[model samples]
Target: MHLLRIALASLANRRFTALLTVFAIALSVCLLLAVERVRHEARASFASTISGTDLIVGARAGSLNLLLYSVFRIGNATNNIRWTSYEQLAAHRQVKWAIPISLGDSHRGYRVLGTSQGYFEHYRYARSQPLRLREGRPFAADPFEVVLGAEVAEALHYRLGDDLVLAHGVASISLLKHDDKPFRVVGVLARTGTPVDRTLHISLAGMQALHVDWQGGMPARGAARVSAEQARAMDLQPEQITAVLLGLHSKIATFSLQREINEYRGEPLLAILPGVALQELWSLMGTAEQALFVVSLFVVLTGLIGMLTAILTSLNERRREMAILRSVGARPWHIAGLLVLEALALALAGALLGLALLYLGIAAAQGPVQAHYGLYLALTVPTLYEWTLLGAILAAALLMGGVPAWRAYRQSLADGLSIRL
Candidate 1:
């Protein structure tokens, strides 16, 4: 305890340098921890993007491709499943519910999804949490009514009763605009921190009506053009859809259903367990995640090196102090112990300050991050892994301090009672 007091007093005498060292370490520590937290949260968010659905069925394609287009709204599907097949599968006894997904439309830059009221009823994310509306109700009988996702509504500044036109294609800058089939926003879903938030939802009938008058991928001219009312009056049953999300009646039936769907003779189809596909997707990204973590580790090492440099540089100026202590009967090990204590003190202070900064940053950026990126950075206590990382940092600091401690020990023994420069 006496040695700790002396070491702290000595650091107080050089408060400016010590503070700078601590601040440097604090910034590095904060950065490392922040990256780790984001990585963990991103993985969790990615895995929870679509949950409670036992299987995702799509027209024959790679599992990753199907997962991307179906859940992520990424690339276009190679082929669309026939609506007849969807009806047959949905009516299967093993299937509890099925939500069909129709893509290839966009509102501004956001993807427009054509689904039934079943999507709003059964689609879930983040631990089976059901979709909730922030305002208004889900689209009812009106084929022209639409429901806006949280991000779509917030980013485009749309509200209930607002009318918007969707383009025929999924391009960000689409040439073929479905101007005649204007849809009214009847509902806005709450922010879900998933791809769902970045999508615009509409009924399957609405999707068919948009392109009902278009032939050969081009809109009809003059009398051939169908107005919204005319299209609504006609049958709007969808012929094909991009994918289907299925919930099984029992968890044990997931594999059986998947096998059956894969072997279906009605049409070529692929069914993948959502959990398996998610794990596969995450593994593909593991390399980049590890690379990021390694980079942050090097940053932390750089900060520790800076601390080592500061301590070693101060050694010459403090030689006289060490000699005085030796003259006053201080043992060489005592001097070494003091230097180690100083390093530990700096590390502890830095770790604490870094934790404080992390929480403050999370609190400040939580809203904007979620608003723009759909990544909710929860302000919660550090997990066990984080605590372990901090502990490792302290241990590394202690190990690094040994270098200066050994130098101080040798110098104090040799320069006993003598002032060196």
Candidate 2:
């Protein structure tokens, strides 16, 4: 108890340097924890983005490529699967339900997804969390009605019944606009913190309506243009679709169904288990993840070095103080213990402060992060791994404490009592 008081009093005397050391450690700890938390949450979010689906079937292409374009909206599909194939797969006896996704157009900057009501009923995220409407309802049977994702509605400031035109391509700036066939916002979906948050959903017929006047990806010059009213009467069946997400009747039949689809004689196709493809995608990202972790670890090491430097520097000024303690019957080992305690104290303070900063940061930036990056950061308690990290840091701090403690222990009373004698 007495030694603790002495340590506290000594730190209070050099509070400026002590506080600075604490602040540095705190910031570093914050960065480390932030990296870890964000990494874990990102993986969780990505993995859960399209769960409950047994397979994602697309035109024969690399599994990673198909997953990227269909799920993450990260790239363009090499080729779209035929609408006939999607129909066949959806009608398969072993299939529980299938959702068709036809991607090509864009509303402002958000991807326009052409899907059926089955998407609302079957598509899920974050482990069976179904899509729900925050305002209005899902797009009705009308071909011109559209549903906006939470981000799309908030960003474009669209309300129910507001009409908006979509661009033909995914580019931010495109000359081809579907102005002749504007879609009215019928619904706004609640935020899912997935790619769905940035999407604009429309019926497959609505998608076909936009391109009805076009041939070979352009408006036919001499061809008659169909108005919205006329498009309602025209055939709106899509000839091709980007991908299909399927649920299976039995988990045991997943591999057999996948093989059957891949071996289909009509057209070359690939049926991939979502979890397996997701793992492949994550494997490709492993290098980047490791890079982030290494950078954060280095940052923490720098902070610990700074604390060590501050303690060692203070030791030189405290030699006389140590000699006085020795004269007062304090053993050299006691002086060492005091130094160790101070280091541990700084580490402990920094760790607690870092946790405060982490949660505060998460709370403050949660909305913006989700809005811009589609990353939903939840403020939660530290995990066991996180606790382990804190423990490792404290252990490192103790080891670092030994350095200055040893210096103080080895110093003779003469070094403190005699100055330049």
Candidate 3:
């Protein structure tokens, strides 16, 4: 107890240096916490996108490519599966449900997905979760009606019943337009923190109706356009679709179902286990994740080293003070305790301050992340991993400061009361 008091008193005498060390540690802690948050939330967002669905089927291609197009709206499919292929597998006895996704267009920057109401029923993201309607109901027999994801609605400032037209592929504007087609917002889905948040969902028939007059990729650039009424009557045959989401009747059938679809010679196609494909994607992405971790480690090390250097450099300036303390009853052990206590105190103060900074940063960026990044960073209670990270930081601080503490102990024992300052 006496040694603790001496340590506290010693730190109080050098309050400026102590505070500087604490703040430096605090800054590093903030960065470490931030990286962990981003990594955790990213994994959560990816896992949530196809929670209920067991498999994702698409034209034969890499599993990662299929996931990116079918679930993430990241890139277009290299080739679309035939409607016959999707229908054949969707009708399989082992299949519980199927949701077909037709992709080829966008509205402004938001990807457009042509699907059926079955999507609202079978498609799950995050953790086998159902779609939650933030406003309005799912499409009720309205052909040109569309539902906006939370991010889409917010970014585009769309409200219920707002009319919008498709932007050819991803182009915001083009020389030609589906002059005959437009859709109105019938519903708005709540945030899912997935690619769904960046998509505009409409019926498959709507996709067909929009391109009915255009025989190929585009209509004659300066040519005559058809009327919306006429498009409503035209045959909107969805000859092909980008991919189909699969739900198995039995969980055990996943492997057999995947095998069946892959071996089916009806047409070239692929079936991907959503979970396995997800793992593969993460593995491919593992390098980037590891790199981020390494950077965070360096950030922490730099801060700890800086604190150590500052205190050690200042230790030389305090030789006279140490000699005076030696003249008093303070022993070498007492001087060592004081240095160690100063380091611990700085670490504790920095940890608390860093937590505050983390909260403020998350709160400030939450809305923007939800809107632009299609990610919801709810300030849920901290995880055990985060506690572990903080513990490690404090451990590093102790080890770093121990070097200076040992040096001071040696000097105090040597100088005693008779030595020169």
Write down the worst ten-residue block by lDDT for model 2.
Answer: 412-421
- Candidate 2 structure lDDT: 0.90
Residues 1-421 of candidate 1 have per-residue lDDT tens digits of 9999999999999999999999999999999999998898789878988989999999998999999999999999999999999999999999999999999999888999999999998998877889999999999888999999898998899989999999988888998999888999999998888889899999999999998888989999999999998988999999999999999899999888899999999999999988889999999999999999999999999989999999999998898898888888889999999999999999999999999999999999999876556577889999999999999999999999999999998873565455556
lDDT of 3 at 221: 42
* 124 Cα displacement, candidate 3 (Å): 1.7
- The candidate, 1 or 3, that scores higher on TM-score is 1
* Cα lDDT of model 3 by residue, 1-421, tens digit: 7767776777778888878877888888999888889888787776666788888989898889998888888888888888988888878899889999999888877889999889998777665668889999887655688999998898889999888888777766655555457788999998877788888998998887777657668764434555567666767669999999988889999998888889889877888988777777878888999899899889888888888887798787877778888777778877777777777777878988988889999999999786555567778767899999899888988887788889988884465444345
Task: Name the runs in model 2 displaced over 4 angstroms.
Answer: 360-381, 416-421
Model 2 per-residue lDDT tens digits across residues 1-421: 8888999899999999999999999999999999998898788777887889999999998999898889877778888888888889989999999999999999777899999999999998876778889999888778999999888889888999899999999998889998888899989998888888889999999998888888889886644887889999989999999999999999999999999999999899999998888877888899999999999999999999999999998877788789999999999899999999999999999999999999999999999887565578888889999999999999999999999999999987777564442
RMSD of 1: 2.0
Assess each prediction's global lDDT (C-alpha) against the native.
0.92, 0.90, 0.82
Better model by lDDT: candidate 1 vs candidate 3: 1
Q: TM-score of the candidate numbered 3? A: 0.88
Better candidate number, 2 or 3, judged by TM-score: 2
lDDT of 1: 0.92
Q: What are the runs in model 1 whose C-alpha is more than 4 Å off? A: 363-381, 412-421
**TM-score, predicted candidate 1 vs. hidden true structure:** 0.94
